[model samples]
Target: MLEAIDIHADALKRAALTAGPAARVPNCPKWTVHDLVAHIALVHCFAIGLAMNRPAKPAPPPDWEDLLGWWDGQRLALREALGQDPGSPAYSPYPGFDVTVGDWTRRMAHETAIHRLDAESALEEAPETRFSPEFANDGIDEFLTYLAPRLGRKTDIRVTTPERTWSLGEALAEVDGPADDVYRALWGRPHRASVTGDLAPVEAP
Candidate 1:
């Protein structure tokens, strides 16, 4: 699993580097490849830090002078932490669960796989990523089982794109689209493959 994580992270970095200078992430809309890379690194560190109960790290202001340094530090921190002790126990916010470092590593790898596609779209390159059916299927499962319900009920965000009714098994922010579209919509990213359903934003919880 640790090896898998390293491979995915390396792939992501390579993908980011390949992004043309003019590339703009459609999902992130306002961010360039550099910003996306930084965001990914920051998220990587944030998750690991929380799991390890590290002290809260500062989030640099967007476009701040120190942003690059901050991102580099976090990226290295995450890499070192994951490598040092992949078997350490960690707590997750999910009820009735204790996720180990191995679990987090795998999770990050799977996440990087999907996001790589979005990054690729911004780069005008083929994000045609490949992963085992086992990993992709597990990601779909985890999203349904653990992540979805956290969004709570919002009767307004109905699915109209698929022209059929469906409910999120969890993460109840409903929308109409292919399963893949649903995946992005869950993350609040827009994809042309989807048409907006009857969604109305309410106050954040």
Candidate 2:
């Protein structure tokens, strides 16, 4: 499992490097890929720190560029820490989320997976990268349940078609597809799902 974590982490690092720091990250319209990379790396450190009694408090980023090297180093540190103990008790954002190592590892894997797609979208390509169904589906669920809230979206974003994308924002449409398609639609991609319901773009949507 640690090996698996390494695989995703390495892939994420590659994506960040290839994508670079200043490239505008479309998923987070205001941020660049560097900001995306910085956000995750900082979160990784914050999670480990909070778990180790280093209390995290939100603060301004001096410049997102400052985090590029930090992300590179922290990615390695996180992998090492998780490799040594992926199931250790840890502090997380949710009040009840005293996550286990397995849980943390899964969380991190899912984190990298979805955000990598953000990078792909920033580069203006349909993301060809993916994960196993369990991880991808878990990510789908997590995105809807957790990350969606973070984006401050009001209603559930549903995908109707699995192949050719039907339109959203025209009216209430019945969209259906794989969970990943649903997830990407909600994440603001030009997704391959049909959408019904009130589909308003949210912060990261």
Candidate 3:
């Protein structure tokens, strides 16, 4: 997961730099590249706080020009924090979930990956960057297990990918495609998958 974070963060930074701070992100309509960078930066800080058991109040990000530098520092700090014992107790942003560095590491990996796609989209880059099947499958499981039910989905749906299949509810409908596409689709990002029934159940809230 640390490796995933590093790879995605690098790609995200490259895309954000090439697109420039003011460039608007189509996927995140309300945010420009600067906003996107700050959001991810802030998320890193939040994760850092929890991992260190400090839970300090979040500091505002620097000006757009300095955002990247700030993000790099926070990223390094977060990496350090997460490098500690994965099973060590840490505060959780969500109640009732495991409060451990491992969980937060997984969350940050997905968070960075999703935003990496947004950054690449802002630059009109090709989809050359893709997650491995193993990683993508794990991401799918994380979403379905930890994030999906929060969306208040009602319909039963089966999502199938080259790497794995996930059944949410009772499998009344089906979505089939490559692992990356299915993962992105579940996150409400543009994808190339095919949906055989109403997709509202699987859409991100």
**How do the predictions measure up, each by TM-score?**
0.62, 0.67, 0.91
Tens-digit per-residue lDDT, 7-103, candidate 1:
6667766666677434788766787877777667667767667557563555644653355556567656766667656678865655666666766
lDDT of 3 at 71: 87
What does candidate 1 score on TM? 0.62
Better of 1 and 3 by lDDT: 3
Native-vs-model 3 lDDT? 0.84
lDDT of 1 at 112: 69
| Candidate 2: Cα lDDT at 97 | 41
How far out, in Å, is residue 173 in model 3? 4.1
In candidate 2, position 137 carries an lDDT of 58
**How does candidate 3 fare on TM-score?**
0.91
Clashing pairs in 1: 148-170, 148-171, 149-170, 149-171
Model 1 Cα displacement at 118 (Å)? 1.9
What's the distance in Å from true for residue 162, model 2? 10
Candidate 3 Cα misplacement greater than 4 A, ranges: 150-155
Q: What is the lDDT of residue 202 in candidate 2?
A: 34
Cα error, residue 11 of model 3, in Å, equals: 0.6
Worst 10 residues of 3 by lDDT: 146-155
